[model samples]
Target: MHPDRYHVTLVLAGRPALHGWWGSEPIARAQFTGLVGRYGQPGTRITLVDEETGATLTEWPETS
Candidate 1:
């Protein structure tokens, strides 16, 4: 796996977030979408980041 790729950080209240990395944006988004579709609720947030620079790439529900 590339060191510089999109990753998902799942935020849950009163619990540590689960982190996973993907090889590309599309795959990451798909995985995240599927996860949220199955288990996410209000206040659940999906964070996307760049593994190499540690920069936050995007956040779900607010694509801007």
Candidate 2:
């Protein structure tokens, strides 16, 4: 992870990895990882829909 660049990466337990571009802060990444870790092995999926355009942005899968 680069301190100067902003990115979000989600490691799924039994699924593929997901990466996103956002504010690349260590704290941000850590927080996200922590949140996901609390849930258990990442196999859960989430669909992020754009309310205005009704478009899907990204789908996240839980990881172990």
Candidate 3:
């Protein structure tokens, strides 16, 4: 079992606003997209990461 290997976080004003953990990446990715549409805004950040690999899978307001 993966055991919550995927993490989703929503940050606002440089503080943690929401957090989620899932054992599946697909589910976590879907939640990430939902969070962006629901809470996406200036000074807000949302990210999905694979905790097991320590890799950032995706983030809102993408960086160059």
Candidate 4:
């Protein structure tokens, strides 16, 4: 991970799903999408957050 890159936190129901840094938002979103595709549950809530700011970047299930 680069020091200048944004850190991403992937969570499912408040538990850590994945963690890493990405050079750009698109790459982070792509990573999030892939993770959900692999480990997402039918009713589970998955979220992507900006680790530095604690802001939610995205969520799974569209309506979640």
Candidate whose lDDT is highest: 3
lDDT (10s digit) by residue, model 2, range 1-64: 3332444445455554654443434454564555455543546543333333445544445324
Q: For candidate 4, lDDT tens digit of each residue in 3-64?
A: 42555555666677667777677887787788778867764666666666667778776663
lDDT of 3 by residue, 1-64 (tens): 5879999999998999999999988889999999999999999999999988899999998988
What's the CA error at residue 20 for candidate 2, in Å?
19
Q: Candidate 4, which segments miss by more than 4 Å at Cα?
A: 1-5, 11-14, 42-45, 61-64
lDDT of 1 by residue, 7-44 (tens): 88788774647888888878887877876776577767
lDDT of each: 0.75, 0.46, 0.94, 0.68
Q: How close is candidate 1 to the true structure, as a TM-score?
A: 0.65
Instruction: Please report the candidate that would top TM-score against the real structure.
Output: 3
**Minimal lDDT window, size 10, model 1:** 55-64
Order by TM-score, highest first: 3, 1, 4, 2
- In candidate 3, position 22 carries an lDDT of 96
Enumerate residue pairs that collide in model 3: none
Clash-forming residue pairs, model 4: none
| Residue 32, model 1, lDDT | 78
TM-score of each: 0.65, 0.30, 0.95, 0.58
Superposed by TM-score, candidate 1 places the C-alpha of residue 32 at a distance from the truth, in angstroms, of 1.3
Give each model's clash number. 0, 10, 0, 0
